[model samples]
Each structure stands twice: as C-alpha cells, then as structure tokens.
Target: MSSFQNLKKSRDARRGKPRPNTSSTSGTSGPGVTNAGDGTYGMDDELASKAREVLSTALGIPLGQDEPGLEFLDDPEVEITNVSSYDSHGRKQNVSPGIDNLRSKDQVTGKGKGKVKQPQVSNEHVRKRGKDEVSHELYKSELEGSGIEVHTLPGKGRGLITKRLIKAGTIILKTPPSISALQNQHFQRVCHGCYLTMKERNIASCKNEKERYEKKMRGELKIKLNRCSGCKVLHYCSRECQLSDWPTHKHECIALQRFRKMYYKTYPTKKQDDDDLSWTQASPEPVRALARIIWKRRVEREKNGGKDGIWWKQIASLESHVSKSTQQEVMRLAQQAQHLQHYLSASIPLKGSDVDVGEDQLLPVNMEDFGFEDVQEVMNFCSSFHVNSFTLSSPSLTPIGVSNSPLMALSNHSCDPNAIVVFPNGAKYMELIAIKDIQSDEEILTSYIDLSCPYDIRQRDLKERYRFQCDCKLCEKSKNQGVDWVDPRWCVRHEGCKGGDGKGKMPVKGSKGVVSVKCDKCQEDFKVNAEEVLSVVQKGVDVLDSDEHRQLDYKTAQKALSTLIPNLQKHLPNHSYPLLSLLRLSSVSHTPPQSPKDLQIASKHIKQAYEACYEVYHQNHATPTLILCEYAKLLSLQDSEQTKMVDLSRNIAMKNTIIRNLLEAIEMLTKAVKQSEITFGKGFVVGKELEGILEGCKEEMERLKRS
Candidate 1:
C-alpha cells in the first residue's frame, strides 16, 4: 500500500475502527458490514464516506482523483506524495495550494493579489540558439586593473596577487557567482531566486485586510514569493527576482517536474528498517548543482552567440586538477554523470502528448543520445566543481548552497590568511576582504579550513582535499620551531610545578609516537600519551557532534558540556575545540544573572573565553568579535547590580571597572564590526547583531552615569 494509505489505516485505527479487509470484491459495504464469504471486516458505506472525507481534507485531493490512473476502488489507497493544485492564473501551483484554505477567515486578507508581470531579459542573441563555444577571455572587464591580478605562482598554479598595497579591511573582491545552486533539501524552504528562507514563521503576517492596507500605505509590507504556477517546482520571492531568474529556471522547470514524477513512481512503498530521512543526507545536491550549470550554459549560448557566453570563459580557465584526481575519484564522477544523463533522458519528451506544456518547453535532444564527448563535458564540469566550489554558509557556519566564482576562487589557501570570504544575506556572492594589510604585489589568501584547529589536523585536511602540503608561513614556523603546546599535559617535573602552570609546555624533540612527553621548558617527563589524550578528545567530539546532543534541551546540553570542560582544560589549547565548545554553550545561556555571585562566576569564564580566543585569532577575526559581544552582555548583567550596592568605596571601584570593561569591549566590537563589513557586505546578518551589541554597550554607558 502507498504511505498515504498506511496513514489512512493508522488514522482509522486511532478512531477505533476495526481493520478493514481492504480487498473485498463487493461493490459496496456499510459501517459494521462483513463479507459473508470470508467473515472478514470491511469499511462499509458510512465508514467509507468518512474515510474519503478524511483523506480529502488531510491530503488535499478528492478520493479516486488524486493521481491520473490511481484506481480508488481496486484498493483502499490514496497516493498523495506528489499532489498539486491550480492557482487563479490557470497555472498549476505547488503545495500550499489554496492559501485561503489554510488560513482562518479573519486572515484572508485580499491585499497584494494583483498579478505580477515578469520582465524580459535584455541581451544580444544569435540567429541560431544553443551553440557552445570556447574563448580565451580570462577575466571580467572590470577586473582589468582592480589592484589585483591573476598570477602563476611557483607551486600553486594560479593565484591572485596584489597590484598595489591594500589596507586591512579593504574590499578586495565583490564578485557575483558564475552559477550557484540551492541545496535540493532547501527547495521548498527557501526561495529559488533570492535565497530567502520561506518558513511560515519567518514570513511577515498581517492580521486583516485593513492592517495589510495600512502597512502597504506605510510602505512596511515586504514583497513575498508567489508559488510558481507552471511546473510547481519553485517559489520566487518577487516578480523581479522571478523575471531575472526565469532564463535559467525555465530550462530546468519541466525537467525537474518529470524527474520528480519518475522518482516518486519508483520510490519504495514499504517502510524500511532504518528510515533516516534527513534531507541533507538524502538530497541530490551535486546533481542539482550540475543541472543548473548545464541549463545556464545552454541559455547563455542561446543568448550570446556561443562566444564563451555568460562569462563562462573565466570558469574555463580554472584548474580542474584532472591529472591529480585518482581513478576512484574519476569513477565516482562518471557514475554521477550517468545517473543525471539517465534522469534527463527520461525527463525529455520524444513523442506526441509527451511534450512538456509550459513556457520555453524542452528542446528535441535526448540526453541518452549524448556520446562520449558530450558526457566528457559533464565529467570536466564535475572535476572543476570538485576543485573550485566554495560553500555558501550562514553567519553561524551552516551551509545553504554551493557555488563557484571565478574572482573568489583566485585567492590561494593560507593557514594564517590575510583575507577572508564571507556570504552576506544568504546570497551566493562571495565578498573577499582583507583582514590584514597587504603590501604591493603580495598574494591575496584565505584559509580553506578553520585556523583554530591543531597543526596536525589542519595539515592533514589540506593535504587530503586540496592535494597540497601547506607550506604557508604559519605551518612552516610550526614545523621548524617545534609544535606549540596546542595539546597539553600535566608536567611531572619539579613535582609542584602546577603542570606548566596554564602556560602549556612544548614537547621535547623526537617526541612523536612517544608514550610519555617531556616538557621542553621544565625538562619534566610526564606520564601522558599524546595518543590517549587524542582518543579522549575524539570521544568528546563524538558526543558533541552526535544528533542526540543537538536534540538535547539547553539544560541537558549544558550538563553534558560541563563534563567535558575539565578534560579539555587539561589537554587542549585554550583557543581549540574544548574552550570553543564551552564558549558556544555559555553564549546560549545569556539570561540575566539571578545574583551578584552568579554573575561574577559567569563573568570569569566569559573573560577567560574572550582572552583565549583573542590570543589565538587576534583582533581581525570573527571569533574575537563573538567573544567581545558576550563580554558586553556579561557587563550589562553586572552593570545592573551597581544600583543595589550600598558601599560607597566599592561602588566607585565597581563603576570604574564597569566603564573600563565596557570601553574595551566597545573597541573590540568596533574592530569586529569593521572586519565583518569587509568580510561580508555591510548588510550581513552577523553585522546587524554586532551593531545591536554596540547599541547595548552605549545604553549601558548611559545607565552607568545615571546610577
């Protein structure tokens, strides 16, 4: 039975109905009716009517008419997996068919119902459409003398070099993406055109038509998405965005619909033993990404006379690392290409009545008819994606999309990079900003991995994925000068030395694979194995990284994190995982203090976290900004206690410290805000929050004077 039918059975059982035979041959049955031949219960007319009513109400489709060929009488089944509805425009709409049906009568505002007209794309076009070309154009016209030049480095093939000295926090590159794809998992939740999260909770709501009209008059109501009335696959946040994106989305619309149909037809009906259905894990993100590239390439060709259309020549110059990729890697990409080719072949129509009925319908080429050279193009695109794609992530570092940009990809990797890439407002554009001053002709660089990771971990990651041994200055220094006390152990030397006294000691030379580490500073031989501490660290990581940990309530998660803090303190660097995790958990618990004593303890940990992160990341990084933000919050809580203090001398001293801390935090936050603007655009999400922190700081200063 279909999952929907199973759901119907479950609902009937919940309603205290007996299990229906579901296979009775009788033309009709009534409530409490039984088949005399087998003495088995069946849903009789009364129950059948109720069931149909429930299915229609819940599944949004009338019984026997859900799918085109589903026989309602043959079995008690209602396949609602791919249901759709039509809008007033005569275009098929996706789910959430009748918004009025879902909303209460009071919320059925008649405002903003005017039809949105899509605009035409303005560009030069070829007489014959859809021709591919190769060109030697390497960069955009604007980038000709933008203080940065693409240069061939010694070991690194191509990298961005400075044409002139650029100051710290300068906007080095502000380039839009060549092509970006929203993760398939986010198809329904985010607008396909503008990348805005479309969750009902996130969207604005008006109480009634009057309020909506008032908001419109006040110019407060924002433009919202209209579920596309064509293929019913995507939502556009605005008509402008829809019109701008139609060129690319048009090609994939029918193919996406057909793919969905084919996919659901073959989907399993039976429940599996392990039914883990996380969209991120199961989604075809790479496939969708490749599909966008293919369609956009075709569209660009049609519009630009096949002269390396849509500035694709810049991407063509990117290194695919074909010679560097192993056989296993090549095979994996080939398999993915084959899967997509098969899907496209099935999606494209070949005969009468099979043709897609919509704007810009599919052309007359079968993907299955693609030959070796055609498939090779896909393979080469995959190779380029493997080497050059940058993750488009939120401020908190959660990935939302995958994109490749020619300008952004030019910056090479560095462990201690002078520049950083930031995604603003969830858009696919990458902003490359200088975190430190760059001298003339100096190469622009950014870290591909987190810089706070221990040296060994960072190096391994770089080698495996980037296919290069990082000889960046930081890595080189660590290699030549011996490892820093990133991983610590209690010193046994001078029995009362306090185990390096929180200033962890470096391991002695030739200490690799040693059972015991001798502190290079104190010459103390400690009975600690690096491997054992690593094992414990991995254990803590496993717990924190588990799905169960994420689902835990705040109090429960705090308790779980508390147990790991001591182990982390004894072993890991203050700027490493242990303290970073502690700081993250503590930041979440930012309620006003219950007492002065409670506030004091929280302040101590907050200070330690700030100092630790500052030491490792320095002033120009995001971590310091985060830590300083928390510091300002802690000061706010402590500042409130000053009004209650009766001791004159203590009050004066406390006031001075509060002002001092507030000033210092303001300074750090200001730098962070500046860096944030450079990294992301001024409109970034985190920058708004930082601005809020700055406002809070200013308010606290005023409150302090009043007290």
Candidate 2:
C-alpha cells in the first residue's frame, strides 16, 4: 500500500467505533490530561452515569455534578471494619476507642492501642471478564519475564498490567486455546440433553462474527437440537446439552425477544439466518445470573436503573415490556430477536458440534432433525468440551471484555489493572495480556467496562455492566486530569493518538512518567496551556512542511518528543508511549543523494535511524521484528555495491546479518509462544497458532537455504 494510503488506513482504524457521532464524545478524554472545560469529567452518559448513582447510594454519598477534585472516599463494595490503625511508620496510632473500634499492639512497647474504623473503599471493583477466562489463562504463558508479576499486584483488582517494559505493537498476547475449527471440537465435553458430544464447529476465529461463521461454513456438520416452542433459537443435539445450557440460554432467548423492535428500527442490513441465533432461548436463569455476574455485590443496580441515560434506562426487554403484534411488528420482532440473538450470542460462546462446524453442510437443523436421537444426549455429544465460547490456544492473552456467560461474567474491572486477557484463536481463542508494567503488590484487575471511555465513562460502565464503581487511577484522575481526558480526541496515524490538533491529533501522550510539552518553533515549553498545545504542534507541523524547514522537522520533532515523552514515562512503559514512537519515527532515513555531501548526510541519518530501530527491538519485539526483516532488506540495498564502508559500518556481511536478524526475530516470537504454552497450560490455542507460524518460518528458512 502507498505510504499515504497506509497512513490514512491507520488513522481511520483509530477513529472508528460502534457509535460515530462526534457529539457523543464526552469532554475530558483523548490526549493530554488537562482540566475539562465542561467542569464535570465527561463521564455520566449511557453507562457510567447510572453506575455512579449506584456507587453514591451504596457509599451513602450523593453524587453531585462535576467537581475539580473529585474523590470517592467510601467504597460500599469493600466490607468496612474496625481495626488498630497504623501511622506513617506502620506503628499503631492511638485514638479514642468505642464499642465498634478496633485496636492493635504498639510497636515501641507492644502495648495495645485504640481502634480505628475502616474507611470506605472506592466503588471501582467491577470489571468485565475476558472473552474467555480459560483463554486469558492460556495467554498468561506469553508473559514470563518479570518487571512486575501481574498476578501478584495489590488492591488494583485482577487485570493485566506490564511485567516489564513493553513496546507498542508487540502482540502483547495472542488468543489462547489456539483451537482451530477441527481442533476446537475435538476436546468438547459431552452434553446433558443427550449423550451426544457438544463440540465447537464454528471456527471463523477472526475478530468478527461473520468471519467465524465463514470458517464454520467450510467444514460444518449438523448436530440436531431439541427446539423451544416460544423461541426457535436454540437447538440441542442432545437433551442433556439442551438441559445443561438451559440455565444460561433461556435468559438470552427471552432477552432476544425484547430487542426485536429495536433491530428493525436500527439495523441497516438484515438476514434470514439470523433466526438460527435464537438458540439462546433455552436459558433464562442467566438473567439473575447475569445480575450477579455483572458486578460486585456492593454495586447496586436498582437505583441506577431508575436514573439517567435514556438508552440504558429505556432498556428494551421482553419480560418487562409488551410489544404491539402487527405482521410488520411480528417480522420486526423476529428480525430484532434474531439480531439480539446474534449480538448476545457473539458476546457468549456457543459450540455447535464436537467436530468443526462448516456452514456449507449445515441444513436447517431442529428438534425433528435428530430423528430417533435424544436431544439431551445428542447435545452432550455435540456441544460439551468443544468450547461453547472459546477457541483455545497456547499462551492466549485475552482482551478484557463483557460477555453473557454467567461464570466468566463475574470478572470485574480496574484501570490500574493487574491481569491481562487475550483471544489466541483470533476471536475464538480466549486469552489476556499484562500490557502495563505491574508491581509486586496489586490486585489482578480487569475492566468489564470499555477502557476507551474517559475515567468517568469507564467508572460508570463498571457500575452498569459489572455493577461497581471504578475509583482506579484512570478514573480518579478524571476531575483534575483535564479536558483532553473527557474525549481523548485521538491521533490519526496507525492506532495513533488522535491528538488535540484539529486534524493532526494523534493518540494522547499518557502521563506514564510526565508529559513535557515542548514548542516546535522555540525550543522551550511547547504548550501555551493545556488546549494550546494543539496550536503549538500545528505551528511546528506547518514549519516542517515549508521547504527550508522540512529538513529540520525530524530534528525538531525528535528533540521535543524526547522532552515531552519522559514526562509520560512515570505512568506507563509501553511502545504506545509517544516518546517511543517519536524515537522510532526519528529513525526512518531516506536514500542518499548522488552528491558526496548529500551521501554523507544520508549515511549519518540512516545509520542513526537503523541503530535506534534496532535498539527498540532489542532481544524480543513483535512489530519491530516484522519491520526489521524489511528494514534489513533496505540496509542490504545500500551496501549492494561493494564498498569498504560496508565492513566499517556493519561487522559481518550486510546480507548475512540481515538474514540472521530476520530469522532471529521470527525465532524470538516463536519462543515467546513456546514460553506461553508452559504458563497458560499446554494444549492451548495460542501455542497451536504458533505452530503454524513456526512452520511458515521453517519453510521460509528452507527457501533461504535454497537461495
């Protein structure tokens, strides 16, 4: 692809979302954590606002409008207790003791000290679980090196954070249970409805559902199901599978009916096969199960339900609401039900057969299709152990996610997180990653809510989705954090931060260490103010665009980035950090001109760039590995003509080194996978996928030998 085109593609991906209206974006979000102009942190919309109310009620604190420094003092989720309090030195601090007061021994004399009451904990506990717990477990294999043992972190809730310094595009973790279509079904547990095996058939294994369905269409076979009368959605290959799935599936079946009208009104495209999704109709116990699973018990959903956010409040549901029954309404209801089924099912994993499901071979399977077979017995044969939701892989690091599964759904959220999740088998393989560098003492945290939201939004989503308030650093920083926080107007390049510049905004520079804004024109503080940083950057870009200034742009951008990026280091240590990106970008060098003067300049810049890029990859890196392979080729091109300088510049032969480095990069990635297999548990999907990559690498090595 053309570089500009590639750039555009990169920009679009960062900007895309489920809802595209710019108006919907809140105030304090995106890049540069500055004071939000709106006064309130831009959270309180669809999910978070309601969630906050629940926190307020549970904590016995009324939630007011935005405050410059908002502090959540009490956390209703944590049990309060009276205990002997400690002072700055961990010594017992004496205080008046009452009946409920707690006491402890004094460090100096070992005497008893007065007791203290427990302060309220923040409401930021509920995080969405990963797509698959097993997958997340699987992905853990990949992160073995230690900066912070993510699983051992204190208080931050279970989530994936960094163990060591990690770069951007490092394939933080692949999907776990690297089960392919064929393999996904091979390990299924038998169904309860029937003695039949319940293997996973669909293996699109891609990010999207359609792609997974396509995979299923290739080699799918029919496993008959016993149908439900009210909603013809679920098909049980055996009665046992049907019965076993009933607890969860029924809630989905019933819930699908409520959204029938919404789909007809909202969806641009519709399909007939949508009806097949109604299979979730068999399970309803999951409704209450979901309630329990959504958030920690302390997060009260009742109060939040009656509060703001029209979309969530007006939640279209089947048991609660009555619908008009016109034929169009009926069709609409059917379509909506189908749509809900599809969406809901996507959130939850369902296995079709003990064998891989190929959509091409599937006929309209229902209760009657089984002929003499028992639905319960048959379902056991098709669905069990096949991974109803997961496509397992070795060392599958999974993404923190919200799903319909009751067991997995109980997982909670935390921004200053601990555990990481992944889907090793593309979408199918469930796994997680510890993207952030973790510490020795922190709770394993994961966010059920979307991380894309500003702190407020994230907090509220936790309350609504998982039913808890999030008072983590990301959320706590919102009030004083700044306007850029509310919307986080992202940068455009590939997954780049959409910077505040009207169009130039890239990803926001996270305050990992401290963000130092430098002026492009004057080599001083670039930010006039929080918002003015955009203008400063724009002016710099304009300066770079001019013919005379173009040559200096790289130098200026690099210098400013160095200063600006170090400030970010305190908060995070990941490639996504602006400093790292800038440093890497600074390394790109062009071909030398024929003129001797130009050639020397080119050689100097090019060599510098090469060293920087190489240093960035070091021993192990994912994207850099890909880049190195191509970059080494570029280096080889330069030294193609025999020159004494080649020896002086690079010790070994240029071609030989490039080949070695490329091979090494591939080998490192493979070994990373191998390492994950041990951590996540063997026989995982990520390891399986690595098998393919290893094979391809080996094949390429053979080709290299022949060449």
Candidate 3:
C-alpha cells in the first residue's frame, strides 16, 4: 500500500471503522460495502443514498448522483473547519461548520420552490487588478526615465542597455523585489521589514538618559524589535513595518507554527535551543523564499482568477538550467523539493477541521491546489533561485539577506563591469548605479562575484556556481596577452634580472614538478621547485579562506607573518596578491594594537597592502578604496601621550616624521573619499563615513602642526 493508503487506514481504525480487505471478493464488507472481482467496490443502494445526504449537508452543496463506493473517503484526513469569509465592511470573517452560513436560506433547506439567490462574487479581483496595473506602470515609468531599457543580446539572452550617456554615480534603476527573505543567521539580528541591523535600529526608545546619550553619540537609537507573537521568528522595527509585511508574513507565521508543533510531536524529548530552532534547521532561507512564492501565487490565483501578473510571469520565465544540471545537482534539487512538499503538506491546515477562528483559517478555495503541480515543478523553482537570486547587501556592502528581482537579473555579468547594484539606505528596493561612464547603446554589465581574486579562481567560481564561462574584455585580454599582461595578482619578480622597470615581474607558470618565470623585458629565465613556491601560496590561500583566521591575536598574527613574508619575498613580488592578503590579515589580526611598536608595525603592513591593492585593483574600484581607508585610519592612531613626549624631548626628527605621516594620512584619506564617491556613490553611507574620517584626519593634522 502507498503512504496515503496507510494513513487513511490508521485514521479509519481510530474512528472505530472496520478496515476493508482488498482480497476478499465474495464477502460483504464494513459499512454496507462489498468488493467484487472487478477493481471497483460496491455499496448498498440505501447506504449510498444516506451517505450522499450527509455529504451534501456537510458540504453545503446538493448532490446529483450517488457514488458507487467509499473512494471519496480514501484520504480520511479532516481539514480545518474554519473558513475565511468577508464581511460587508471588507474585513475577514472566519465562519465555522464548513461555509454552510454562506448559503441562502431556501438553498439550505433543499427547497427549489423560492427563487434561489446566487452567491455574491467578491470585487477583490477588480481591486487586485488595478493595484497590479498601477505597479506595472510605476515600474515602466521608472525604467523609461532611468536611461536604460531591456534589449536582446547575441548570446546572453535578455540584457539591460543604456539608452543615453550615463555618468558615474548616476542611479540607473531602482526596483522593488519580487520576493526576498533574510538568511537564517540574520533572523534575529536584522529586521524583517526594513532589513536594518541591531546596531542601526533608528527608532529611539531608550528608557534611561545614559542609554539615550550613548545611542546619540553613536548616531543610533535603542529600539526594541516587535516580534511576531505567533511564530516568534520574525522581528520588525515597528508596528508599521509589521503591518506592511503582514501579507507575506501571515502565511509564514502559520506554516512555521504548524511545522514546530509537528516537529515536537515527532521528537517529543528534543530540547529547543533557540526560538527559531525548529524551522531554522528544517526550512532555511531558500526554502522559506520558495514557500512565500507558493503562498503568493495561491493568493493571486484566488483573488485574480489566476491572472499572470508581472511578478509571476517574470519569476516563471527565469532560467532553471534543469537540462544542464549535473546528476548530483539534480538529486539535491529533488531532495529539496521533497522537503518542501513535506513541509507544506504537514503545515497547511485542511478545509474543515474545528480549529480556532483566527487569521490561520484556510480559505474556502481547494486545499489540494498548493500552487505547484508536482515535485518537478518545485525542483524547477529551487534551481531557478541558484541563478536568479541576488545577495542583498546593506549600503556598506555587508550581506544581510537574499532577494530576487527579475528586472535586476536581466543585467549580464562582466569582471570589469561599468554598473553595480546596491540597496541604498538599507531599504528593500535595489538601485543600479553606474560605476563608469557609458555611451549610448552600451550594454550594462555588473559583476556577479567578487572581482578581487585572480583569473583562475574567478573562472572556476563562475563555472561552478553560475554554470558559464566568462568572456568579458578582461577575460579576453588575459587569455590573449597572457595573465601577467592583464593581472598583477599572480606575478613573481626575479632576483638577479635587471631589465625593464626595477619592479618588473612575470606570471608564475608551470606544472607541479617545476615552476619557471621569464622576465618580460630581458627574457631572463629562472626555474625553481614548484613545490616550494606553490605550496607556500596554497597555505596562504587556505589561511585567508579559513573562518578561524577571520580574527587572530597579536602573537598568532606575528608568527604567521614571520613565516610567510620571508618565504614569499624570496619567490614572489611584494605586490603579489597572496603576499598582500597575508599582510592585510596580519595588520587586522592585531585588533586595536597592543603597544605603540605594535601599532607602527600594523600601520606599515597596511601601507604595504594598500600599495599592492592600488596596483592590482582599478583606481576607482571599491577594494582599493576600502584598503586606502584602512591605511589612513591606521596611520592616524598616534596617541596624545606620544605627541606630549615628542614635545617634552624637543625631538626635531621625531616631530618631523609625525608631521609627514599626518600629511600623508590626510592625502590618502582625500584620495579614498574621491574613489569612494565613484565606487560606492556620493550619497552612500560608505562615502559619507569616509568623508567623516577625512575631516578627523585634517583636524589631527592641524593639532600636530600646532604642537
């Protein structure tokens, strides 16, 4: 027997009904039912008539003919009884006993004598259609004035192209998400409505003066989040935000509540670690996003007669890459689809059980229609997210959630992109801004992955995650002229060859056995054991990639640098990517710097890293700008006590050195501010923060000069 059959049998047995036998062909069965040699079961005429009467009364509908068997009760799970109804004032009403109260008086009595009144159809369709039309118009208006339009490209399918000249820092497009969800790790720390972090909550609700003063000094406010009382999972900054999110949150809340109850019943002794313990592990961010999409479609179907709106049409048209998926990937998608089916089936309330008449009540629509047709459909949605979803980040470029907007996904990928997508002011809407000047009819491109890595790593990541090889201008240049000609990250300098510039270096090349590098100017060749250089570079890469090394103590940082710097300098240039990454790691690993000597050492490393970053990344790129900011901040760490000592000793040399350092720090900060304006935009939070730091550096410079 199938799982549904087993479930039905258990439910019938619990209700004190005799279990029907499949093999007994000659005997009379339970409840006036009999089985013949044929596949169909037979029921007595009198019993069949009575069953029809009961069913018609319970369903609030008249039955035309009697069925042959009890096949209607094959799935015996009772649906929740409460049904969603509407009042005259346009408010939801939960009516119990299966929508019987919705019928006219004459119809309920089975009397066709009086004129039967037809049920009133809701105007929700008209209202919803109008709203959708208005939203579509708004999107079109935004696109029309934004100087970009969707166009067909040769091989990239749909792409956004500039209609006119677009300067750097110009906002190209601002679009709201079709759907978005916070990751599991950010459920509590980030607001579900505005996507604000705990430290950036702007509503002031401090109870004491001291707390208020501290918050004011930090340019923040102490606001308590309002958590949903039902699921207790999502948190909002205010009641207004909660209300604004209710349309989507209501379904999530109900599903999460049912999921938790079912989970605890299955594992009765399982201890809850946190409030989101149950659903967080079972339904991650992607699963939750898929669930919301399903629920939204269901709502759209019921409210608008299954009309294909802009959001649904775009979502359905996204590329799933199902045909190109690997066997392991298909298996993973299938497993996720199964989990989604289990979650929805177990959580969504049935159509006629006596549950509490709250917002959790099911609509009178068919409960069997759960948006998706089968596992294949759900699997398609799961795969679509892998390609179409964007990592939603804060204004400061910190990732906070995942979002999908079909409009934004139209832009193609390029390592050397002219545009960038960002969420300005922590809002949910995405804004595409030009990072470089673009002429009319130019295709707008954005980087889907980090551009800080070398060519091989970027290619590998793009192929593995996005399932496509990059053929951008940068990639083409690197392939045509060699990686060393375009990329500075993987170059190594020769010790004895004195040709070209003094810093002339060539790309590291060769197999695992022997590594060789030839000078680009003098054609001088040097060979080394690949194991020595490659193994050390691999170690540095591992250290940089490890999560444990995100923060390291001064001792650990010193040890790592002591071992890596000498070995790397012998075979690689100071501006090599791996060397620069280690220096950056060592500089930040000191945290606040234990002593003045430690501070000076950290500053020196950061300055070196900044130089390497400037050489590697573009002048107007975010990576170099951020590195410059760090270098300036490190140099400005001289304490008041150090200045006082210099004054007391009248050390002319030390005073001059400090003054020069301050001047250099100010110049770096100024350059960083200018670069941030192009990379992060002028009005962005990062640019404003850089400006604030620049002002502080200027004040410090003047103070040192006066002293």
The lDDT leader among the candidates is 3
In candidate 1, the residue pairs with backbone N, CA or C atoms under 3 Å apart (3 or more residues apart, or in different chains) clash, namely: 29-44, 29-45, 30-44, 30-45
What tens-digit string does per-residue lDDT give for candidate 3 at 1-707?
22222222322332242211110100000000111111011122232223211100011111221111111111121211100111111011101001111110000000000111111112342222222233234347457667666554444555566768988877778777667777565666566877765434432134333454567799665355556666667877666667767677676775665655545544457776435453354455655766677777777877877664556767776666566778855765665554455444433543444343322222222324856666576667766654566544444333444566666666666667677665545556766777678777676666554454566765554454445666676766665665235256666666776774323333344446765666665666776667677777877765543312113344655777778877887777666756765676566555357778777877787787777766655565444555676676666665535665556237868777777777877787787778767755665544454455566767767776776
lDDT of all predictions, in order shown? 0.45, 0.27, 0.51
Instruction: Give the Cα-based TM-score of candidate 3 against the true structure.
Output: 0.68
lDDT of 2 by residue, 1-707 (tens): 22112212322333232111111100000000000011011111222212211100011111221111112212111110101111111111110000000011000000000111111122232122222243234333444443322221123222333334543223333322211111111112212122122222111123333444455587543343334332343334444444544443444333333233223323325554434343222222212222222221112233455232221211111011012123432332232222222233222222345113421111112322212144333222111111111111111111111111111111224443333333322323333334333333323233232232234434432222122344555556644654333223122211122332221123243323323443222323322132334333344323222211112344454455444434433222223212233322333322223344433443343333334433222222212222332233233333323333455244446546545644764655465455544323344433443444455555645654555
lDDT, model 3, position 426:
59
Candidate 3 lowest-lDDT run of ten: 23-32
Candidate 1, after superposition: displacement of residue 506 in Å? 7.6
Clashes of 3: 9
Between candidates 1 and 2, which one is better according to lDDT? 1
Query: Order of all candidates by TM-score, from best down to worst?
Result: 3, 1, 2
